[model samples]
Target: MSLRTSLTAFPRQALSRPNWRQTVKTSLVNYGDQRCGMAATAHPVTQDSTGSKGPTAMVFLNMGGPSTTQEVGDFLSRLFADGDLIPLGRLQSYLGPLISRRRTPKIEKQYADIGGGSPIRKWSEYQCAEMCKILDKISPESAPHKPYVAFRYANPLTEQMYTQLLDDGFGRGKGGRAVAFTQYPQYSCSTTGSSLNELWKWRNRLEGKRANGGKEGEGAIQWSVIDRWPTHESLVEAFARNIEEQLATYPEERRNDVVLLFSAHSLPMSVINRGDPYAAEVAATVHAVMQRLNFTNPYRLCWQSQVGPSAWLGAQTSDTVQNYVKKGHADLLLIPIAFTSDHIETLYELDKEVIHEANSPGVKRVESLNGNPIFIKGLADIAAAHMRSGQTCSRQMTLRCQGCTSERCLEQKKFFAGPELSSLVR
Candidate 1:
């Protein structure tokens, strides 16, 4: 099929009860029927090679890609936004600190399980670099250029890097043509939304800098983003491959016996009750993989990395494992479907916390899947999709469920040009 680029329209708010099952079913069916949207058509999703007036860059940024050292004070301060104490209007502000202080020591101890801190920053850098190289390979024409993967939290983007890309342009470059994309496999109000929020800051700054610089570039420098790829074929195929690899870690005969549990970051019950499609999206991703893998054993979905005083997303892994154990099952496997790589949540939380908490010896070994070729291809698939499609429209375009709300949506932050989501406290 000929390539189809340019999004028909930006996804609006998802309706209250849009039946997530049906939403994902349509995307999966449409994608599987054929590899329809494959070309880097339109203006280019991540990196625009239009050779136009502005630069188009593909930034695979994350919440915490720490290139710079984290500031302990700032982290805590942000953790307790609008000052350390006070029952402010911000629920996350009040609840986050209350939970953080209580959980920090324990969380720190767990983090130590992974040999210090969440090396999320380190791994993010790795993923970004890997993605950059990956995109360069697929787009080739993105020549004389490369995608820049930066962190939004731990390493908060620096002014220099932002200006460099915005000034130089991404798409084709120097011709008011730059395309940007986010590399989150699954969309969440927290992850992909937060990163895009970060980009908007720089975009605003660039507008000011440009005005002051006297219009060196022409026309508006446009940028596009791939918000999330919950059901992209590349993602499902790659996740299946990853699961198969972990199954291989078991004996060939036992592979079939290995029960599958796909876990993503747990959200709050309030959000889900309010209609956050996050849980549904996570389930959708798992479903896609299971469909592709053709799972014979029972497949299940659970929540991981739950936080805050209020109840977070449900069906804790431990609880789920206990259910399995009660069912006369001994061996069980968990796949962290949310995260891109082996971060603190994966290494400590699942591998250590849940394991030891459940079975006497914990899990035989919480299998690890990171930066797999298929997963990388999934990232590439999304980028390529955006390039051909132009916009990142969602199944619930006209409406967004409660959890579908972007944490960065209309939220403003003051960039310190240093690490740590600057002004998170404010």
Candidate 2:
């Protein structure tokens, strides 16, 4: 069953009518208050003191997907309109909306093939919830670490998440801080850049409102970015461990010969040419995971999810699979190196399309790092490490893009640099 369908299949009781109406009324009131710019003191969502040092919120950012076939067009519209992904210098205002509307049906069909929505959001929520539990236990100093999701081009967009954090009394004072962690395992100017840009724009707007005669109790926010961690120890270990576990499922004698094919989402060749470190970082991640596994097996890193006629990073994954098959390597194991959770890219593209194209009984795919205990611990460790040092963009996690002249790579830190206060406070 589709996730939406399953979720709505619960038995309804007439006895609950009054309670449902009350709940709906309360939500409408809250929504109305927010729309009206009611002062924070009007109806603070949290009971905690706004001026007090608040809980450190770890806000994860990503490109969210449509929840239903109906939303596919809207999702595509937002994505295409983004200048970071598709730079339409002069024609963006007109051409952008045209392209999105034109592509909706085809995209909607794609969603219908894969259970009518992207499961990425659900998996991300699961991962974050699990990570929250781990953070609470291992780092009691940062015990009340709250997890928030900020999507780039969909519902729960950065603005909504910002409003939510404000409502929760998260960003108010000197010690009040939040972590803007990119959920993408490998960094790219397009994915991470687009999301962070939206967030900063929202922050600027809020600050502008405050500066222009807004209420004092409205509160100011401070936040840091967990920009990149392509080679973190725990992350490497998680991938290596999952690879090992998946490999064991194959016949013992055949495991030694199985090719490890790591596939990441492709970006336009233009981005790589302009010195985005994404491709290199992906290679580094694969290398680190391989070192951890200590495997002598043949492996190849390829790119997938190419869109548009523009040149994209090649050794296209589908082409790679066919080439390897022709070379007499039947036993294959596909690992989604870049994606952290099972989303449309993994569930539909790789799991369905690529696997079908390979058309071999020997082909298999390992599970993504969704709600994996070890992986969640790894994420917790990343956040905890940042919270300890009282820095938003840590030197330890930073990578210099080769041939990179673009300011997008390092601009977030300079723009969103927060106060130097320990976010590890409970």
Candidate 3:
């Protein structure tokens, strides 16, 4: 959908309503029926019952985790190898494989701070559980509470989760036909597109390893991927309103002087050089909030967590702080644009390192947008809207031309496009 689609204005009623999850779920169901074409269009896989058959709506939640609990080097390599963690068509291609390798040690040290690695796997599971319950409550009649599963790109429970779901009868039909769901909010290469490639890979291997492994047993289990929800209105409203509160945190005099520093998970410069829309989407979200806020305060976007040998998105938060300091600007506000919820990157990089930069720069203060009520409500609203819509979003990719709708996986340059005059170079 076009990013600017305006949704019906609704009050940000996140926690106040009864069974907020259920309300959102019901809304998603109705909204899906109206906008996305649902109910009659929805699939009911089994023509005949097999005792344990379920309504078909298999979703795959692709996320990052602390796969670093193991020896740092091995885990780091494996994490990069999985290739699902970065935003597909992101800054990484420009940064190249070497950057990922070089950054592993630094990543390991950061993980060490949070007790060996991130609890991404654990927290992802938490998100999954909460979503499943919300879906069941809101759309009990829609489907038989089709199970929602979580998978990771960088940590424990990798491709195995997909296999387990298949085994659990997602494709128990006579044919090798089943649909899959993706649980990432935005569609970028590293998140949705890359995860699908991994899923397809697992399916190929299973097809070879097991006797007609992924083939829908009685019938093919339909493969439907829920790639992203980039332009959903509730999502936008949620985020827009959340940003409003972050702006409110500062005092009147400091408010106008403060700058909103939107930060997202950073990849290499090569990816953006090639053509990843991740940074664009981030900017769009920020602009959307600005429009919603109707504020004239200056704002900027920056990248963080530059891991690997190749150059990643510039103005690493630290560098951004330095640049602002050098330019003689002090007040800054950090808004994590990429992640829907808080993860390790927030705790370590933004919270710890950025704080250090704020101190070093002698700035007034360094504030983060984490734990803001509106932000949390925005997340809940996005999830609720998606559950109601019941349709997958358009996937993101890097294509050379509209003439050839193919994504060419080209190699990227190193040294960060290296040693640039400015850290915040676009």
Q: Considering every candidate listed, which one attains the maximal TM-score?
A: 2
Whole-model Cα lDDT of every candidate shown, in order = 0.54, 0.73, 0.52
Task: Give the TM-score (vs. native) of candidate 1.
Answer: 0.70
TM-score of each: 0.70, 0.81, 0.68
- Which consecutive 10 residues in model 3 have the weakest lDDT in total? 409-418
User: What C-alpha lDDT, on a 0 to 100 scale, does residue 65 get in candidate 2?
Assistant: 90
How well is each residue in 149-260 modelled by candidate 2, as lDDT tens digits? 8988777778999888877776444235677889987777788877877887777666534444654334456678887889887678667767887788889989888999
Please report how far candidate 3 places residue 64 from its true position, in Å: 1.3
lDDT of 3 by residue, 275-305 (tens): 5566777677767766766756788888888
Error of 3 at 377 (Å): 7.8
Reference-based TM-score, model 3: 0.68
lDDT of 1 by residue, 1-426 (tens): 111211111122221114423543454444334335653322333334452321235566665422222343344444345221111345756665675566556655555556766656544544444555556655554432345655554444534457656545431234343445555566654555555555665665565444447542344455555556677775665566556656667777766787787777776666567565567777888888888888665678888666446677778876888788778666677888777767666776777777777764324443343534445545654665556554433323224454443343534322211123332322
Model 3: CA > 4 A from native: 1-60, 71-74, 82-106, 146-152, 174-184, 207-218, 360-426
